[model samples]
Target: MRTDFWKKTAAFGLQDDAVNILSNAADYKSQVLEQIAKAEQRIIITALYLEDDDAGREILAALHQASLTKPNLKITILVDYHRARRGRIGESKSEGNAKLYCEYNEKYNSNVKVFGVPIKAREIFGVLHLKGLVFDDILLYTGASINDVYVQQHDRYRLDRYFVLNQKGICDSIESFMNEIMLVSAATPRIDSRPIADYSEIKLAHKQLMRTLKKTKYKEPRASNKNQLSARMFLGFGRRGNDLNKLIKNLFDQTKEELVLYTPYFNFPAPLMRSLRKLLKHGKKVTIVVGDKTANDFYISPEKPFNTIGGLPYLYETILQKFLKSHNKYLEQGLLKVYIWKDNDNSFHLKGVCSDSKRHLLSGHNLNPRAWSLDIENGILLDDPNKTLEQRIEAEKVQILKHCIQINNYDELETMSDYPAPVQKILGKIKRVKGDIILKRFI
Candidate 1:
């Protein structure tokens, strides 16, 4: 099949509607609750991680309460099966959020359903990392998972982007994609079945899901008269049959002016990096907004005195430093711009990129080896040249920038050693350890 065929099929007509961009967890909670209260038909959610943390429980409680009042309100939650079974770094056994969610459905609420999809075996190179919520004809997309930090349950927060749109065509197409491609696939099993955690079963289900994904055809759904917005969805997998990769290539190849990207991690696949260099060499304006080492991370190992489970911050900072060192001339010439996020006590976890201020991409796909090789990711493409989506993007950019301390010159970077005293000491100790390969996976 030709690549353009899929691209054309995905690029359907849309109508104009008001777009709302939410900046933090507090805003997200308000918006989600508001939508749930008004929902008349159904609520569809997809998340990478859904822990049984305070925030997660609160959301579940709210949903349950809403269902009690509005018995007809149907809710479906799709999360990663593998994540559901595995415990966090310091936790023992699963808190059983998935199981609890299932029980809630079976016992008290007849209108709610939860499903888990294991993506590691399903897409050997990727895992399911998309986060979205669809209610009636409205869609909410974000890069946050269900946790206290993600929703600002206590004092801490996780930096992310939240967007709302009421485009009927886009909403309907995404809903269909969830139902036809995800719900029907073997990778996704009904939570009520009490699926076992066997490697063989996971592998089998993965193969089945891949087969279905390969054969599935996605076309832009016909727009209803009430529709008001134009959007497109893109996936990133498969080798020769992967239309998502082609779509990304086309976006870069066809860009005439500028590209702006927002990703928590800074590492890029070889081809993507080459494409970025090519764009820079061609004098195109490129702005990359990434999370600073400390702010972009997830866990800070309190046990090890400043060690972190995820090496996101270190990896991203190293990549940025290397890129700047290699492309010093480009930096001086104003062809490249890099911004880092550093909220007071928050962590940054949003992902996706926008190109030419006309195209927008949103997903949970962090730009790192873990995301590329072990997580499934999904994002949407929107051509918004009229600045319709600028409000949300700009607001997030500004808020994130507020927490960052800029490193504009190589001289500044060389002298920048203002890490927390404890972190600085920890970094020094880590550099002394020679055989610390085990730390790479978790860090």
Candidate 2:
């Protein structure tokens, strides 16, 4: 049943034998390093940002070492331009990731090039939120950046999906997209002494490139996947430009039995909310797995001094409470499941959707308003209409739920009074001023 659906849906091709779903971040990092060491021809990595930390240095060192051995190896990394040169909001001024790139050029002399791509003029409005790592003929897709927490180099880890795809069509398409589209754009290859003013000089070209990318879709020779599995790539930006959004909503509308959503952030765009409401009304099963408030990356301990961003988890919790309240009937009947992921001091950044037993969305898109209308997002849709990967998907779900606890009632979430003094005071002000609505739309 699903095999036919995938045949009809996939624009390109998918290989069943080549798909490998990894267990966790530590495992993912090891595999990535191994692949990097073995890559012979080229290595391309794209992510939101790459920090200059222990893990980041380790990744760069591996790439440089590989280039030293395979002197002909081509390595290119792309990170958000505005984000690459800026420090954290409250942190003291320092040379950001770009400086590290410059140092690698001078010290390693291994021909590893890091490019900065600005999806929009500034960081607040938009960014280069792309995700993929192409090593020779293999493509590694994850929502994680090369950082200490994301790579799980320490006790703290950010939970995310790690999917490995090894198909000629998939590899070629991604490589072509990087070489022809991203590299040709206004992406800066060297920013050693370049000023922000100089970077902004290419703003018009960047805008034009984004427009072109909005209209561009990966084109490759279509082939029937082995074992009846099919996959397609989708990219989008802004509200209407997002094909991933459209694909997810279509999955919701098409779901016959069950739907599962895994997002670190709890917020959902209006369209998804409407589809979910309709699905629930039709007596379909819906499960939402999200990070606990404490697991939010922005969550600071109540004992710590409050930063304005620290209140984000509370705001999301308030929204979840309202959602649960409005859909209490679904909860009572066991048609709705909400699981909150928490693992001590670890955090979460999972994002994907599974519909019924066939279609799975592996993506970096958070499914939030910001992702829907602001950032450049991309993902690959694996439609296994024949249920070829059912066991794998189910196993992945179990892994994700290992540290999660389901919410039986909305009362599990703390109210304003139960929050820390600073969080309570801050949320109280936002609620009074009706600023929560704005934050929902933007954050």
Candidate 3:
């Protein structure tokens, strides 16, 4: 059974000292810049979107300068094709972030190449959500993209888990996937150049790309049992037969003593939520730390103009309240603990898992329906049966919980009656017409 598990996971046999975790977002930004500045061979970045804001420009400029410093430095950036061509929600139509990419390309004389990946025809259905920034052999993995709020370039910030993995073989596999699969695909194209091809013109190639991704897998090396710290990377696409989703469910099922889940959103996929119910019935300790409604990026303050998007935070809060109400008995018995994380004006984007302090998952997967059934997601599963990462894991938990307050009472969460008038109106209309059902699958 043990040998079969190792072969199925195909995890890397890495030393305990090789994995490093950062505490804050500022350090994440500095590490990215430093890695780019010092990289020798190649730099590859994969994210959903890179905003055309101050932080995005700064990072893009760093890549440009790094390529200039080392003429042979290979650089390739991948972002969602639909996201690159369109503006943010509720904004006027414009060329979007591709404009910034084009400007930088022109300034650097086409030294940097940014490819737009058409994961789907539209932005809402699915996206290019592979997370990690590679400089040479080191990988900076986070849910954050190149944005002011994500990297803490300004006063306001978004908190997310940051991990650095130093493994050459892992880097080789990621780079090879891009070099072999993505770059050569007709659906993926350079958005940095002017007069880029339109999605309509390449509809067939786009379908072919999505079909190919659904059937493809990451290049896996030989798996061996080292009886030490190790990591396995898995790609998640559709819900059926998804090895990553199965891995996540397995972690939940295999938890004997405790399980700690970190996510910005409270919406869990139906299957995981059902598993949580069983875990509680079995008397396992489950702790969930989620962001407060105000800590949501879509939150609009009372003084700000209310838009339809502002209702997102309230919708998630409603989901949390429902979960709490259903599990109120477990809460009183101290079998389940829920913490609401809030840090002034900053937002939250953290996502990961820790099972009994032995097996840990580092991922950008939201555990929500959108991520489970639609988006392209990936995660690194670390198995440490000896509890080798106990101190470091506890430290991370303390840092994340510093600004949090436990939900001892289910009534503490706001009800729909407590929402602002505009938010109430929007949510009421959506529920009245049953649009929220559709929204849950895509958002």
Pairs in steric clash, model 1? 15-228, 15-229, 126-375, 126-376, 127-375, 127-376, 128-376, 129-376, 311-443
- Can you rank all candidates by lDDT, best first? 3, 2, 1
Local accuracy of candidate 2 as per-residue lDDT tens digits, 120-165? 7778888888899999888999999888999998887888999998
Superposing all C-alpha atoms, what RMSD in Å does each candidate have to the true structure?
4.2, 2.3, 1.6
lDDT of each: 0.67, 0.84, 0.88
lDDT digits (tens) for residues 1-443 of candidate 1? 24233347445444555467787788888888888888887788888766777788778777777778888887878887767666666567874566667665656655676777876553334556766888888888898887888888899888788888776666677678888788876667766335544546557767778667655544465542222234677665544555555556566655678877777777765556777888898898777777766675554643554444443355446557778888777778888777767666578877776766767776676654455435555677665758676676777778767876655654444212554455445545665773233333222
Off by over 4 Å in 3: 1-7, 223-227
lDDT score for candidate 3 against the true structure: 0.88
Model 1 TM-score (2 dp): 0.85
lDDT of 3 by residue, 175-220 (tens): 9889888898888989999898899987898888777777777777
Largest lDDT belongs to which candidate?
Answer: 3
Candidate 3's TM-score: 0.97
- True-structure Cα RMSD, model 3: 1.6
